[model samples]
Target: MAALGWMVLALVFLDEVLAAVAAGVWGSHAGGWPLAVLAPVVVVAVWWAFASPRARWGGPVVRRVVKVLVFGLASVGLWVAGHHGWALALLVFSVVVNGLAQLPSIRGLVAEQERPPAS
Candidate 1:
């Protein structure tokens, strides 16, 4: 879970970098600002979803699902809202990153749940 969280953090950082580069290339400061803010939110959301004891199921699955859906929708919305090229790229990148990051946690949770009881 910790490792997965870190992976999500790395992806968020990558997204920020990509957004900055895109913004610079396009000469759109507005495009970069939203991504800058979103990066931290992504990190926080991932951390809370994976690390927080109060999170549903006390595991990463539910959180990951929610994060994927929310982020996916948000990305599409951004794309529709005139972000265009960079936004679309970022959205696709985020989906891939989040999916990969959640894999380990989902596997671990499943393994734990599938364990046999002591004799």
Candidate 2:
């Protein structure tokens, strides 16, 4: 069970990286080059500022909200970029994986390894 939980936890990071990729894809389609480069930078910045586990701000609740917002935006970006199937898949997978990661057994495993960031 813990192994499965850890895998799901790892998937969360992969999903986050894919979010940045989706943003880049959308930006590439929206503009020639600048946006393609800029979009993922913005996404990374937002994630680092609010969602990253070591971020200086935000408690657990805020962290969850930021994750949802980031994932939601990524899904929308994928859909707007004409990758509807990928968009839906990302959204569903993110939601399910994230929910699984929140289970007490899994959450405890993670919390034990790292102290929570500031609120």
Candidate 3:
């Protein structure tokens, strides 16, 4: 279970990176060079500000919503960018993994791993 928890944690980070890629691709399709360059930057900035683990802004609910939006938009972005299969995979994987991560047991395991060892 602990190992599974850790894997889930890793997946969460991977999901974030993929979401940025999706956003970048979408931007390139939505607009040309400038937006292509700016889209990922904006996504990263917003994640850092409100969705990242280290984020200082927003309450838990707000953070969760922001996270969902990021992932949700990523799914949409991939679809709009014409990567239909990828879009569906990301959508299902993100939803399932994220939902599973919220389970108390998994959260506890993740938290335990994050805790500093006894001095």
Candidate 4:
């Protein structure tokens, strides 16, 4: 479960990077240099505010919600950016893998590891 948690974290980062790239590409097509640069900055800011490990938001629920939103939107963004096959693959991978991580047994396993041992 801990390993899965790490995998999920890595996936989250990948999703964010893909999202930033997609946004920048879209911006480049729609506007120009400023928009291209600003798109990634905005995406990163929102991600840091709502999805980062130290996000100033709710608990696990909020984090999960943000994760879904971020990855889902990024999947769409990838499709729009002309990577249809990659987008679908990412969507499927994120859904199935994240779903597994949400299983109660897996969550409990991860939570158990997070606890400090009693003296």
Q: Give the candidate number with the greatest TM-score.
A: 2
Q: Where is model 3 more than 4 Å wrong at Cα?
A: 113-119
TM-score rank order: 2, 3, 4, 1
lDDT per residue (tens digit) for residues 25-117 in model 4: 766755788988987788788778887656786367787787787677767866777878977887887787667666776667657767899
Off by over 4 Å in 2: 115-119
Better of 1 and 3 by TM-score: 3
State the lDDT at 97 in candidate 4. 68
lDDT of 4: 0.73
As a TM-score, model 2 comes out at: 0.90
1-119: candidate 3 lDDT, tens digit per residue: 77788788888888888888888899999997788889999999999999876688967887899999999998998899899999999999899888888889888986776789999
lDDT of each: 0.56, 0.88, 0.88, 0.73
Give me candidate 3's TM-score against the actual structure: 0.87
The ten-residue window of minimal lDDT in model 1 covers 20-29
* Model 4 TM-score (2 dp): 0.67
lDDT of 2: 0.88
Off by over 4 Å in 4: 1-5, 103-119
Model 2 weakest lDDT span, ten residues long: 109-118
Reference-based TM-score of each model = 0.41, 0.90, 0.87, 0.67
